[model samples]
Target: MATEGLRALLHSVRYEVLPAKASEEKVLAHVPRDVVVTVTASPVKGLEPTLDLTTRLAGHGYRVVPHVPARLLRDDAHLKEVAGRLREAGVDDVFVPAGDADPPAGDFHGALPVLRRLGELGSPFARVGVTGYPESHPIIDDDITVQAMWDKREHATYIVSNLCFDPRVLGEWLVRIRRRQVELPVHVGVAGPVQRAKLLAMATKIGVGESTRFLTRHPSWFLRFAAPGGYAPERLLTRARDALTAPSSGVAGLHLFTFNQIAETERWRRALLDRLGG
Candidate 1:
């Protein structure tokens, strides 16, 4: 039987994007109309690509959330300008991250500072999201990362975890959050079904710092599962689904890292939902 909790959780799935050409149409076609779509700001493509994509998606009536990488914002003035653009496009939510840019482009070096500036700007966003790591980060210690979450909790409306392959770890992390009294809703990050080689190539091409951090933190898992075979996110999701639907879990939804494999990811999601009779 499909539980109400499962249905509610499934309805909250969101798709992630790389700011590539034709990505807007591709993602919109693959994702359900009501699902929130987030466009990532690539270091190579910079923020403009994501901004442009978000504007286009919003115009088409999709709930679009663009990532505002702190390093890319030149300063407070630039931040205001960006907020204005988003408001004009009808965007009322955003995901703030520290970005992969090597050096600080402005006063904000991390998400907390940029989030503070956004608060000061009095933007009209209904919700603001910050990244969370269930696994350890490459450079930041666990204590520092956890403290960062506590600092951001006051400003952030939700937490979107970085990608993780282990559902037990994610479930335990959710428990930990509740124990710590951090009640923010969480969006569990899961990569969709993608070919191993293709995923690896795309990761390298995109130059994502998070991928490096993930590999560093979970070398054994990466070595074992990320081989030249088809990879399925279902294994992880299935293991986590029960915990995800637990009343006390506080995990709100899924954040799918499509890796631009929109078609395959959509297929996987639909199949899973169908298996769940929803």
Candidate 2:
């Protein structure tokens, strides 16, 4: 049943791209064309890299979702240009995160404001997604993070939970979200099969404090990476299989934080599919 659930969950995957320049082709080559790929935004690096990456990925026939960080846009003009550019590139979906830019770059403060602005600009995106944190966010409080989901429910098409190691935490959070009556399909975020050292280095590069908090929560999984055995996405999926299969949880699909370790991750995914005879 667990393998079946994992197989079902694999049908649609959301691959997140790192903010820096790497071999976009090298990483993306490992992913299937039909899969959904998302580009991450960096406050320091700005959204230009992500836009370039998104356009390139779309050209390669991948459905790309670029992160439109609210704080990154300086004003209405900037927002409008971005919206126009996305539509021009045939990119119809966007993931709006409040962004990690401390102090923010402009008037926009959070995801809701960006969503509203997008609507004012004709909601250029066909599908809009918002972030969901099952585990407590390193910076934000538990209450505020949960409330943000309810707040953005009207604008977002779906919810993608942030990378979470504990299935119990994910299950409980899904039940709570459903209880609150948020009907959007929730795609659970699980780390792809990445080497421990590589994962840590990538995490630190992205956000050291956030990465530290995540590792602090899952010491056993960290140890698994340190030794011969590495952390498997299936392990967490199997652990949370019951919650995922439950109808009320509204578990929709899988969201993989590939960390640009695409070749290794792709191999793991293909092997799992063959093992399941999918």
lDDT of each: 0.81, 0.81
The worst-scoring run of ten residues by lDDT in candidate 2 lies at 206-215
Clashing pairs in 2: none
The runs of at least 3 residues in candidate 1 whose Cα sits more than 4 Å from the true structure, single-residue gaps closed, are: 1-4, 207-230
Kindly list the per-residue Cα lDDT of model 2 for residues 1-278, writing each as its tens digit.
65677688887677787855674766566788877888888776788988988888888788999998898888878888988888899999999988877678888988898888788777778799999988888778977888889899888899989878888998999988888888899888888988888877876776665566556765665775676555777788778989887878887888888887878777887887888789
Clashes of 1: 0
Worst 10 residues of 1 by lDDT: 213-222
Residue 146's lDDT within candidate 2 is 82
Q: Count the backbone clashes (under 3 Å) in each candidate.
A: 0, 0
Candidate 1 TM-score, true structure as reference = 0.91
